[model samples]
Target: MRSNIYIGSKRRLSIIALGLIIFLFTTGIAHAQTVDGNKYQLTLAEAIRFAKSQNKLVQVATLEESAAKEDRKDAYNAALPAITANGSYQRFSQLTLFTDGLSHSTTGPRKPSANGAALGIDALFNIYSGGKQRALQDEQQSRVHLARLNTLDQSGSIALQTAHQYLELVRLNDLQKLILDQLNRAQTRLNNINSLYKNQKVTKSDVLRAEVVLSNVQLSLQENENDLTITNRKLDVLLNIPDSVRIAPVDSAGMPKPAIDSLLPFIESAGVTAYSVQKIKENIELQKARVKGVESSNKPSIGFYTAYGLNYPNYLFFPPVNQAYAIGFVGLKAQYSISSLYHNKSKVAAAKLRERELEVQQQANNDNVRTEASSYYIKYTEALTRIAVNERSVEQAQVNYRIVNTKYLNQLSLLTDLLDADNLYQESRFNMIRAQTNALNIYYNILYISGNL
Candidate 1:
């Protein structure tokens, strides 16, 4: 019974000790998270959503898009028939009218002769107008298409900026961590160096060098912390939030990028080419341009009209007089300006120039986009290589630092060796961090170009 009680007590003690360790580790982690820093953790999707809804550039793009939509709607509605209703009432004072040939020998003043009210409804169905309306409609549609494309472009630009800034913030944070770790190692080395100097085993110069290195690292850390603050403020501004509110970089770990071939094809095909996204813009303009050509060449537009009216002798909306007069008439209206004054020629020339300009702009955009795609692809590859190389470097530096520290303590290596290894490890770790961010940024940039943003 006594042995069993001892075993139970030991087990209970082990459990209590394990609980304390878990509690302490959890508390430390929580405390570290609360440490003074500007990073407010945000995921990529979350940041994108915030920017889309709140970013200033995005707001402008959205407003312009809405206006373009309204213009397009108005243009389309112009294609339908139009109707108007009009009403009028009029009374004439007593007068002798000479046009009626009643002015001769009129001894007494003529009484008021005509008073009437009339209501009419008229509608115009554009039978034909040299394709003018169609051309106008098409032009408006093209403008809308251009506006939409511009909106996409704006979004892409802003997304790329936001994504790049996010990555930079992450790199800054990693560098801060790397510097802190190096400072700790430097402090440890300083302690050892002081001990050896006290025993006359090491020179004072070694201690001073270590202190300088430590101080420099401390300064770098402080600068990086400041940069982190700046990044957070800028990000908040991009999100249109209060600058005091902090935002951290999104984690870029394990993000999948689109295939380069697929992305390249998309960039290549996005201009005046067939199956291009910008084809809508081009086609709408082309349609408008052709109709304008026809309209200008036709030179004459004719409209036919007829109307009938009945009038009573009273000026009330409800005619009071019983007597009524009825009249009906029909007529044809036409317009043709005899012109060799280069107006038609100029219209045609301008239309052709505009079409060519749209084509040229699209071509230039194609080239620009293709060049950007290739550059970003190359950048992604380089960043990935850098991350790999830097990861190995960090590991090697860690091993070197550990070995040299042990040797220095045992008096087998110099203090300079230990410091060098320590500095190398810290720099390599920060480089790795920066490379990780660069890789992620390039991936997001590619997505923006590909219209995935």
Candidate 2:
């Protein structure tokens, strides 16, 4: 009876232990999630969105665009009339008295006090500025357009970077899994060889060789894990997420099939209008506008001005003294500056030179875009061919590994042959991964360089 009670107690203790372990494991997972801030199932679209929102480069570019808009607005407002108000007050220590020399008597000053105040409003309307205002408006418009394009360019660049990093993280994750699988196979083989050596069916050297292979596989696994960690960190930084958070990508989709037929057409269409190319072209226009503005500066400007003022102790003869009165004036005017004329020739020459330089740069940039697109296309095709070839190689390697593995089991093949075949199979798989990833990267690069991304 006592023995039965002890057995029941033992069973209850085991059950309690299992429950504790379960509780600890569940809580551990929760703690990991909590420490990492939040778990995000990041997708390509989501990554791009996050980068656009959080990237400092994109933010700065947006601000520049806004500033350019304000500049354009100011330029537009320059064509409107300007109005200003003025006021002044003065207090004298003593009043001035006019004396009659013949009578030797001083007539009392008309004003009761030595203090005075005046207020005025002045208005000016620019009738003409020799087209300088129009030129300025055009230049400002070009700047605004350039700023907008630059913002788009910045966004495209950030998106491309995010895609590259995300793809690399995915590739590293796949590679780590592959290496872990290899390590597992090596460990299983090592165990088999150890048993065979103990039974005297295999030599001690065989066991040592197997152990060495297992250690190498383990080292490879460790290196791959480290690589995964670093790649994850890079992606986290790009997404502006916490580094401690572990990302498990659920999108295991491999490289997409390329639409070869449309790729060249898309590149050609997007190449001409690329933001970089367009910005340079617009800069040329801006410089031309500056030349016009410089020429306009040497010409004359016509305007109209009007002013009305009220003053205490009116000094006008028509207005009675010792009283506040109003004075008004209106006039048309024309003015020319010889200072700008002195430098106009040089300024125009400099502006033309800058415009020409920009044209040359624009042409060069267009050529570069074409070249980059062509090169990326070639790389993508090569990757496709490599994928096909490596896929065949993997098939062949798999068959060879199976045959060698069977032969080794039957003692009809050397362990070296089996190990070599296994290594070949693993290498072929890695090659396939490389081919696929390279193809994906190059295709996206083509899109990026074309400014279509």
Candidate 3:
């Protein structure tokens, strides 16, 4: 919300305005932006780094992290002794010790010259007040720790989402290419059929079907290209970059090849890691609650302070005289409000209940995290297998299309048969690419589960 905009640039404070208008208007932008001029160049590592540093959500996490660090420092400082200093100066027309007109000598009011100043200092070292200070310090520390852990949790979430978006963009790019390829093939077939019909070797229906197929493919390609433009804009906003910037996807050769053998180990490790980290954080809170309970039971407090001034008189008795006295007194003191009997039965009970609640929550979290980690691991391996099988299927489909087209040219296949085979081939290839992209994403998903991404 706070930024220095170039002259005449509207304040882009909300997604509704930009997303509905300028950001979505990707008329001049190309799909798949590249950092360098290398061909086929989007990489997982690059995406991860870019998202971590540049994503709008990631920036918010960074700010929370910075604030947490400051809070931790303040909590740590609370353990030290507290010191305070105060000073004041004032003047009055008269300082009355005793006045001349009392009840006639039964009382006396001494006249005093009017000026005074006070300077005082105090230092209260926590000798020990039933552990209240320590408890408060612990609570502060726990809150700080929670801020950091939560940031990491959010980081993992953001990374997973970005990876998904990036993978889908890649899919859209590949699908667009496939659509173009299909369009070209349809046009070539249409030309062949028309030539054959001119020689009285093909039916009019064959020419008509080929032209229709080409028209359909062309229309689909147009829509796909538009969708790709929109996808690129979404990615640009995430990267905090200009949406109109050009972009292009890398080839399959750059996708990650995960270590399949470690899949189970990674899952197990993620489960255990989550449990341990959560226990460490939760225990801190419980310990703080217990410390507070003890301090309240001890029922102790204090309040005492002293202030003094240098003695000086600027006026003389009756005849007017000037005098300054060099005198000062320093003293130390303290007071206590100790309970005569135990009075906090409810607080102790609440602390015990709170600790029990954390224990229950810890157990619940372990169950949930284990389930998710295992599921993610199994999904990774399954996706890998799917991609391999789908790739082979697509290769075979390509061969089928080539053979069918050649047969049709030789008058051995029907026009409908040829069109259907081409459609199947394109669809198969797209499926393969999608499976591969998803597999690559699932493999990296292990890091997200372990909170290491």
Candidate 4:
């Protein structure tokens, strides 16, 4: 009786452990599902924001902007007085002097010290550098401005790219559902055809035709799934997300279409406020500054210089002194490079040419921006038109599909007619989705080209 009681306790314990394991497993799965569900949900604006922050191109542009800032600082520092301190120690093995006379004689210090040390601080402030200093400073400032513009440009580019991929993913997601529905329909039709064949109502050829349609649809679905995988991975890289995470674009159904009454505003904005245009303007300024810098080389430079020092053996005196002595001096210095007058002519011309080249480039960029903006606007309008047309087509195709299906069921239509109607319905739906996504993409493109995205 005691043994039976122990066995019963053991069995109860075993059952309890089993139940605990099952509970933990179920809880873990539920938690994982919740986390994964939250992780993959993303909106278009959120995706663009994430890409701007995490894209490698945007990050690199930001780093370049930082470097340009440092360059500006260095240029500013160049305008300030340079101060430096230096110290030196030397040991002399021997000290000798020669006296110039009819009978040449060599002399030595009475009590020469073997070691000598010196310390000094010197400062030089530029009073004038023929405007070179100002020109260089201006050039560096222009560089900083250009870098900032470049960062903005890169951020915009990344945003647009992210939007494209995100929209494509959304399109694929929608298509996936539509294709699945088509697959189910195809499967049902095939099953019905088989049933009809068994009952001698339809021939074996009907079953084979249905099978082919199903196979083609299955292939299409597989291709779309592959495209989804690739697009998701690309978006993950842009957002710096883990590959294991899958993104699900928020449904854009019933989202209001972007509206614009005219393309003139976009084209105008692209010419004035576009990052490309701004960068070129800054580059032209930079080239002008460089020309000034080169021309300044033909002029003279002037500065104030001062130095103070303490030396162990005062070499300033004719006779060597054992005690250390302090020495200081201040003076104005000026210099001219005679060769620069001739040598810099070519350099100045080259700089001016470069400035002109930038001006030409600026004009070209303006033209390109206008053209690109107008192109996108036109495309956007075209997509809107397509959307309307495809909507009507989908409605008509759906009606036709229903009619043909009913006729086939009533033995009043051939299987081919039903299959064709089904194909038209699926194609119309696909086209409608494409038109919607394409319109969204082109709308964003317009914003991107105008630098307003």
Write down the TM-score of every candidate: 0.76, 0.85, 0.78, 0.87
Model 3: lDDT equals: 0.67
Give the distance in Å from residue 174's predicted Cα in candidate 3 to where it truly belongs.
1.9
Using TM-score as the measure, name the better of candidate 2 and candidate 4: 4
The positional error of residue 338 in candidate 2, measured at the CA in angstroms, is 3.2
Cα lDDT over the full model 4: 0.84
Cα lDDT of model 3 by residue, 1-453, tens digit: 234464224444233334323432343333334354222234545555556656778778778878877876786687576667676676755323435766334433233535555555556555545666667667766766666676676667777776776777888888887888888788888889999999998989888878888889888988888887887777667656666544555545226667778677767777566634554555758566565846554556543333344434544255433455433333444444555244556667667777777777677777777888888778887888887888888889999999999998999998888888998899888878878887777766777776667
Cα displacement (Å) at residue 323, model 2: 1.8
Q: Taking the tens digit of each residue's C-alpha lDDT, what string does model 1 give over 286-357? A: 555574845555566666565566665543434354465555555566776567245576666666776677
Q: Where is the poorest 10-residue window by lDDT in model 1? A: 29-38
For model 2, the superposed segments whose C-alpha errors exceed 4 Å read 1-37, 95-113, 318-320
Q: For candidate 3, which ten residues in a row score worst on lDDT?
A: 23-32
lDDT of each: 0.67, 0.78, 0.67, 0.84
Please give, for residues 1-453, the per-residue lDDT of candidate 4 as tens digits: 999998997776556434433433554422212124224566787778767876888999999999999999999999899999999998876545556753666656444477889999999999999999999999999999999888888899989999999989998999999999999999998988888889899888888989999999999999999999999989888876555457778746335677767655776788888888888898889998999899999999999999999888776667776889998999999999999978988998888988899999999999998888888888888988998899999999999999999899778999999999999999999899888988888888887778777
Can you tell me which runs of candidate 4 are displaced by over 4 Å? 1-39, 95-113, 262-264
Total colliding residue pairs, candidate 1: 0
On TM-score, the stronger of 1 and 2 is 2
Ranking by lDDT: 4, 2, 1, 3
Candidate 3: misplaced stretches above 4 Å?
1-41, 89-110, 251-256, 275-343
